[model samples]
Target: MDKDLERFVEYCKIDTQSNDTSDATPSEAKELNLTKLLYKQLKEMGLEAEIDQYGRLYSKLPGEKGLDVIGLNSHVDTALEVSGKNVKPQLISSYEGGVIKLNDEYSMSPSDFPRLKNYIGSDLIVTSGDTLLGGDDKAGVSIIMEVISYYVSHPEEKHHPIAILFTPDEEIGRGPEHFDAKKFGADYAYTVDGADVDMIEDENFNAAHADIVIEGVSIHPGEAKGKMINALRLCNEFDASLDPDAKPEYTSGREGFNHLMAMNGTAEKASMHYIIRNHDMDLLQKQKDEFVSIKHRLEAKYPKAKINLDIVDDYKNMHEVFLKDPRAVEHADEVFASLGITARHEPIRGGTDGATFSFNGCPTPNLGTGSYNHHGRFEYLSVKDYRKMIEIVKAIVKA
Candidate 1:
């Protein structure tokens, strides 16, 4: 456990923040820093490891032939919202409660995040406020690595064949762009990238993205009247036409939202990016339809303005795939029972790389990494829970 935590800390220090703007498969060249390290570590374990051209690391451990070939996956990249470089993680033990300060400027409290109270008696790894802790999926990677290390050291222990995948660009939704179901060769898999250790994710939001561009006539302010069509003003009006309550800040659990991700414009031209999400297909369609409705409404309102709205499907709910083949969830239930752990099936508020893998053929459900408040400075990992999840994975593959 100590050695695995050491690996996690070492990984946290490396900057692996993915770039959404970059057209590269891994998104950022720096992402290969961690990928290379993981590749070397996996090789040290005496397993067959290789990195694909897309920057994904695949490794395998031979087990009993009769058992199913299981797969484990996690991403190495950190969120782009905060800096992941030069992360100084703080190790806190014997917590007596109250506020835990990340730094002078930032502190985490139960008042703001009630989940802090759950880790009252456990050890924690937190950020130093200048950057995010990167536990979102790194902890996931650590858990998988620990499981592999265990079987490697104890070759006598019988278990299922394990296929490992460490991906890059997950923070930007490109983690599964290079996924190969045949190459991994697993009957089922799990993406260890969730918050709590006591929950399993079986469903995720059906997602789509809308790119809106508005063109208008730019006239001098002195002659501006009905003749002057400000594209920026139209952008504001277009966003304002959407339902005020149907936004990310206002909704949660089962409720869909239309999130305005980015907006930029001038008097003659403007563009807005929105991500539409919902657990239900019908509701997601409504959200997409609403975008078109607003566009047409605005077009009628402004005859001189030209609005080009493009909506593309990002990913679908993995629940549909799971419905056809539920062995992944069923096996997880058995593993939890064997370990005397009670984990509930919950829908992930966000998507994981598992969603894409599931649609492709592998019904990959998601598990937790014992981390909380991801993609921000206040992010933390419960060391006690982290250790526990390692045990859970070991039991899952036991032969």
Candidate 2:
């Protein structure tokens, strides 16, 4: 087995699912298990590595004088959307290009995901139907570790200084909450947290989170006819007011979305959490304004009810910041072309730590690790594509 694949499977077995409700940097103590492992490995390789109180692992590899310092980053925590515990990885040495039955309850079919056809005869790493594979970023983590190992072994190979960062809670949008760009000492960086081998994302969504709370008047069943205001009903009304076609399921490419992530509560008090995204700042603001407008109109209709809305800015598009200095992405493009890999530039439908790092002055772009069907039971990784990513990283560093 490839060392990177071995490392990936080993890390996936550890449950590091982050918590959004926690106020801590990592949001979960279990994430430190993986962080400690990474820090130990980096130290064993003679690299200067340390894990902070927040579980963010940082390492440095020194280069010869007059070389530019580059940063390589990936998250250690997996998404909370699905289970990441006790992952039993199934490795197919040579895929025959057909439907894969992960377990009794679920199967991955090329018909559902046409991208599977591209990996025919290549090795695939998948998870059991009950949990996610955590390949969304673990593959990235493995790739970086393997690249560092390569350079450490080949002392004759000259390269630039490398700054390695393994962050937690990226799946929860808090990966860079404690990241210090000046301390990282990198002129530019690339986040190896994207999907597919061909994708090299320079743009991402201008993201925000909206929380709506509605207070209603609860009355007795017999007297509820004229006195009661159902907060749950108002929640549905607000959901219906949004453009249904602009949701994640219905939209693609550069289109934006207003995703209602969660809703809970009784008639007396209810809360709805929504995520608004757009590549265009003006359009993102328009969607936010529409949310406020809907809340105001509903408040007027239910005069006896009280409603409160709060919109928080999460991260902006990295392209806006990185475009000013195109060296990072241009270097990646040259690397991909040199390796005979077609470079595909697309706007990331979701936010990445690179967006936060870029806004913090690192001017980071995102690279792919061949993870597919992320944050779900159908997640899988292509071994061939994973190897390509290692080469891509090596080339980027050398560039």
Candidate 3:
């Protein structure tokens, strides 16, 4: 098997799901399993690699001097919504089109995912219906690894100084926590974390989260008539009050939405966790305002109860930074164009570690991993496009 393909399949077998509830760095200890593998592999390849206490793996592959130091980053941890454990990758030799059964329980069709038609003759790697494939960033990781491996083995082929970063908990939005850009030593970077191989992304959602706590007056059923105030009902009412159309299911292409991540409670107290996002900063604030507005309304309706709403800024859109300096994106486009690929610049509906990296000193843009339907059982990787990404990143670092 090819090195990149071999690396991807091997890494997918390990479980590295991030935990949102956990306050610890990396969120879960199991995440280090893959980090340790990367650390060992980097060492074996004679590269200077270090694994930090925060579960971040940083490495450098020395290249031609005086060239801009370029960075490549991808997250190690998978999404929290799906089960990334025991992920069995299903490989298709040549996709002729139609339904590709993952297992007895589930199957993927081009009708459901029109993009599948884009890779008719390409080899593919899919999940076995039981769990997620973890291709969201693993594919990115493999691409970076292969690129580094290529330049390392053939020192005669000159390239720019390369800084590699594999982060944890990107799915939970903590990928950039404790990250030091100056220490990364990269003038610019690219996050290989998107879907399409031909697209380059610099704009991302202005992300913020809202945590709502509802305190209610509980009374016995025997005399509960007018004194009873159920927190569960208030939580449901709070969700129902939000605009029905203003949600992820209904929004697309730079549109903003308030996603209810999780909510649970009883008659005494309940909590609702929501993530609000928009490309425009003003629109993002309006969504936050809506959260505060509903809290006041619910409190007024249930005078005996107290409602606490906390909204915190997570990450801003990286577009602002790119607008000031377009060198990183322009460089990527030029490289892609040289490789006979038209670089499509699009806004990212979701944020990548690049968003935070751009805000920090290093201007960063997001590239793709040729993986689709991320964070779900239906997720799959296109071997042809995946290989193309390796070439694209390789071109970006060429002297």
Clashing pairs in 1: none
List, residue by residue over 1-399, the lDDT tens digit for candidate 2: 767888989988889999989997679999888889999999999999878777788899987668778899999999888898888989988999999999998999999989889889899999899999999789999999999999999988888899999999988878998898877888899899988787889999999999999999999878898899999988999899988888999999999999999999998899999999999999999999999899889988989999999999988999888668888888888888998988999998888789888888898999989788899999999888888888889888873
Clashing pairs in 3: none
Task: List model 3 lDDT by residue over 1-399, tens digit each.
Answer: 666888999999999999999999989999999999999989999999988888889999888889999999999899877899899998898899989999898999999999999989889999999999999889998999999889888888999999999999999889999888977889999999998999999898999999999999999978999998999999999999987877999999989999999998889999999999999999898888888888888888888998989999988999999889888998998999899998898888887789889989899999999999998999999999999999999999999
User: Model 3: what TM-score?
Assistant: 0.88
Clash total of candidate 3: 0
Per-candidate clashes come to 0, 0, 0
Ranking by TM-score: 1, 2, 3
User: Which prediction has more favorable TM-score, 1 or 2?
Assistant: 1
Tens-place lDDT per residue, model 1, 1-399, is 379889889899999999999998889999999999989999998999899999999999999998889999999999999999899999988676889988889998989988878888888999999999999789999899999999999999999999999999999988999799999989999999987777889999999999999999998999887798999999999999998998999998889999999999898999999999999999999999999999999999898899999999988999999889999999999889778888798888888799999999899999989988899999999898898899988988889
Report the poorest 10 consecutive residues by lDDT, candidate 3: 344-353
Candidate 1: where are CA atoms >4 Å away? 217-228
TM-score of each: 0.92, 0.89, 0.88
User: What are the Cα lDDT values of the candidates?
Assistant: 0.91, 0.89, 0.91
lDDT of 1: 0.91
